[model samples]
Target: MILYTTTPIEMIFPCDQTVFDNYKTISYQGVPLVVEQTDNHYRIVQILSSNPNDFMKEELAPGQLISFI
Candidate 1:
C-alpha cells in the first residue's frame, strides 16, 4: 500500500524504546548535535544548529564518527 502523510515514519511505525536509549543531544565544539553512542565514539545523527556554517564542517556531518574526550 502507498502511504502518503506528512507525519514522520518513526511516528507511524514506532521504534523500540531501547533503540532511543543510546541517542543523545550534546554540544560539541559549541554546536548542538544529536549523536548515537557506538563502541568508542558517537555517530552523528543530526545537527541542531541554526547556523548554516555549522553544516559546512565535514567533521560534524551526519553519520560521521566522533570520539568524545
Candidate 2:
C-alpha cells in the first residue's frame, strides 16, 4: 500500500494517548511554547511564536530543559 498526502506521518498513525498527555502549552518569558513534562523539569518541544528573534535565543531552543518556579 502507498500513501500520498501532505499530512505528517505522526498524524496518520496517531501515537499513544499517554504520549500526548505529557505535552502542554504554556507561556514562558512572553513566548508561547509547547513542552513535555519530565522529572523535575519541562523539556522544550516547540516554539509557538512567529518572531524571528525568539528562535535566535539559545535558551529558547527546542530540547532545552526548563524548571518552573
Candidate 3:
C-alpha cells in the first residue's frame, strides 16, 4: 500500500491486509488500504482534504487516494 507523506511515499514491509489494525489515522494522513499493483510497487500523491471520506481497510493501489481530516 502507498500513502501521501508530504516528503515521499514511505513503503512499509509485510503489507498484508491483516496489518490494517496497526495503521492509525491520527498517526498517518489516511487509513490502511489495499491497492492492486502487478509491479509490486505503488506511488503516493499528497493532496490536502478535510474529513477525508476514506476509511481504513485492506490495501490501496496507485489509483487509491485518501484524505485527512
Candidate 4:
C-alpha cells in the first residue's frame, strides 16, 4: 500500500474496523483516518479523513471504492 499525507489521506480501503483497531492513532498535525475491515476488497485510491466524518457522514460508507491510474 502507499503512504499518503496530503490534505485528504487517500486510501484504497473503506477503513476496516478490525484492522484499524490493531493500529494506534498516529499524530499528523492534520486529519487522521483508518481503513475499515469491511472495505478490504478495494484495490485503488480510496481517500479517507477525520474531518469529512465518513463514519458520521457515511462518506465512505460500509464499502467505498476508488480507481488509481
Highest lDDT scorer:
2
lDDT of 3 at 16: 62
- Note the residue pairs that clash in candidate 3: 33-58, 33-59, 33-60, 34-58, 34-59, 34-60, 35-59, 35-60, 35-61
Total backbone collisions for each predicted model: 0, 0, 9, 8
lDDT of 4 by residue, 11-66 (tens): 32536655435432322224343332223333212334546554454434434432
Task: Compare candidates 2 and 3 on TM-score and give the better one.
Answer: 2
What tens digits encode model 3's per-residue C-alpha lDDT throughout 15-45? 6655434333222335433332223333223
Candidate 2 wrongly placed segments (more than 4 Å): 1-13
TM-score winner: 2
Q: What RMSD, rounded to one decimal, does every model reach?
A: 4.2, 3.9, 13.1, 12.3
- The sequence of per-residue lDDT tens digits that candidate 2 reaches over residues 1-69 is 789954446535758877778888899999999888988899998888989999999999999999985
The parts of candidate 3 lying over 4 Å away from their true place are: 1-30, 43-69
Q: In model 4, where do residues sit more than 4 Å from their true spots? A: 1-52
Error of 2 at 17 (Å): 0.4
User: What is candidate 4's local distance difference test score?
Assistant: 0.38
Lowest-lDDT window of 10 residues in candidate 3? 36-45
Clashing pairs in 4: 11-46, 14-36, 15-35, 15-36, 16-35, 16-36, 16-37, 17-37
| lDDT to native, each model | 0.85, 0.85, 0.37, 0.38
Relative to the true structure, candidate 4 reaches a TM of 0.23
Local error of candidate 2 at residue 19 (angstroms): 0.5
